[model samples]
Structures are given as structure tokens and as C-alpha cells.
Target: MNNQRRTVLKSGSGAALLGMLAAAGIITPGMALADWNKAAFDAKSMADTLKALGAGSPADSKDVQVTGPDIAENGAVVPVGVASSLPNISMVAILIEKNPNALAATFVLPEGTEANVQTRVKMGQTSNIYALVKSDGKFFMATKEIKVTLGGCGG
Candidate 1:
């Protein structure tokens, strides 16, 4: 109980300070938010998704790696991982080719951070999953097929 009170007090003071800073025009509300790529997330096709993300016709690359089960018995929660060995990786995204929305997830990496992420995405059926990466102002891709025995995404 004492720890919870301390956490609340500490965070409350931090938030108050931020509010003061915002009121003083030291920081704006917009500066505190990350840019949301709504168009890419809402795109229904791979080509459209890529276009929304400012990538067109990405080349195949072995430097990008995708790790997931060859066959997922349960499609509701399929574990997937992506990593890239290429230099200057600024962004990475996961794509499920057969899903209603081809783009599943996207990550924006800051400078010098490791370009690797693990996530779980719903699969309606068996599909080719891709790790699309943007490095040095160019896009590259790696692909793998995942067999889903069950349906997710209302399939």
C-alpha cells in the first residue's frame, strides 16, 4: 500500500511538471505524440500498404529474417519475430498476405537501437508472412509461409 502511494505521488508530481511545461509553451501536445501511420495500418492490400508507408516494390533480402512456426495449430495467437542485420534500419513491418488487412504491425526504430521485435498476430488462414524493412532510405523484404490450421480474424 505504501509503495503504491509513493508511485502515485511520484508520477503525479511528474505529470504536474509536464502540464506546467505545456502551459508555458516549452512543449506542445503534438510533440508528445508519436506519428501514427493510419493509412498503412488501414490498407487492405500489400501494394497499398507499401505505398502508404512510402515504400514501393521492395527488393528481396536475406538480411531481413522472420521466425515463426511453419504450422500454427491455433491461428488466434501465432508467435512471430523479425530482425534485420542490415545497417541503418529505420523501420520494420510485418505483413500477412492473406489477412483482410495485409499490414499487421509496424515499428519505427530510433538511431542506434537494435532492429528486432517479437509479436503475436491473428491469422485467418495459412498465409505468406513477410518482414519488410526500410534501411538507408530503401526497402527490402523477406518472406515465409505459415500454415494455420484454425481460423482467427473471424475466418
Candidate 2:
């Protein structure tokens, strides 16, 4: 029993030391973090956001879908989702037409990842939510209107 206890402590201490080294930056992480797109998120208009994201004049597509309640009971926590059935989707972004910043969220999909995402966003009022999808170096988009009973972005 004493020998087993010593073995457990030895392995646990080694793991803890390695974790400390990583946390202290003595060891580098294997994965690199993606840089934030400040310009895209700070854009006040849909067009500007698209421009910042390098997607120009996206065509309307039935293959892209934006799902949300027609009327959001609470503006602060409106549920939304974006999905694309199109092949080779590389990115998906959500835009709120009425928000102070039109660009709400953007997601970059890795290879083999499904082109679908769900999230909650705040709405200032009744507005059209746009889902922009990028596939095979081309951009496509769809929009859905959501009415907010109470203002979330400050009435």
C-alpha cells in the first residue's frame, strides 16, 4: 500500500510541475490562437462589416439558413442559429441589422467541421438578422426578421 501511494504521488507531482511550466510560459502551447477581427466587429453597417471580413457583395442563397423566433420574448437573450448545407463552408457570421455594431459574431470553421452554429444575441428592436456563409471562396447570405418586445441594446 505504501509503495502504491508513493507511485501515485510521483506521477501526480510530475504532471503538476509540467502544468506549472506551461502556465508560466516556459513551455509553448501546441495550438496557436486566431487573431481577433477588430474592424469587422466594430463596423456599424452590414456592408462595412462584410468589407472588413473580405466578403464583398454576397449573393442571397437558399442554402444558408438563419433560425430564430419571429418574436423574441426578451430582447436581451434572443436565441439565434446559422447553418449552411453548402459544401466546403469555411466561415459563418451573424449580423444584427439594428445593433449599434451590425456585426454580432463571426466563426471560422476548421476542415471537416459542420457549418452550423447556435448563439444568443441582444437586439435593440425589430430587425433583420443576417447569416453570411462562405464556401469555396464565395459568399452567400440569408436573413430573418426578429421582433423584440423589449429593447436589449438600450431603448
TM-score of every candidate: 0.76, 0.77
Off by over 4 Å in 1: 1-34
TM-score of candidate 2 relative to the true fold: 0.77
- Report the C-alpha displacement of residue 32, candidate 2, in angstroms: 15
TM-score for predicted model 1 compared with the true structure: 0.76
lDDT tens readout by residue for model 1, 43-80: 99889998998999999999999999999999999999
Put down candidate 2 lDDT per residue, 93-149, tens digits, no spaces. Answer: 999988999998888999989998999999999999999999999999999999999
Query: Which 10-residue window in model 2 sums to the lowest lDDT?
Result: 26-35
> Which residue pairs in candidate 2 collide?
none
Q: All candidates' lDDT scores?
A: 0.87, 0.87
lDDT of 1 at 86: 95
Clashing pairs in 1: none
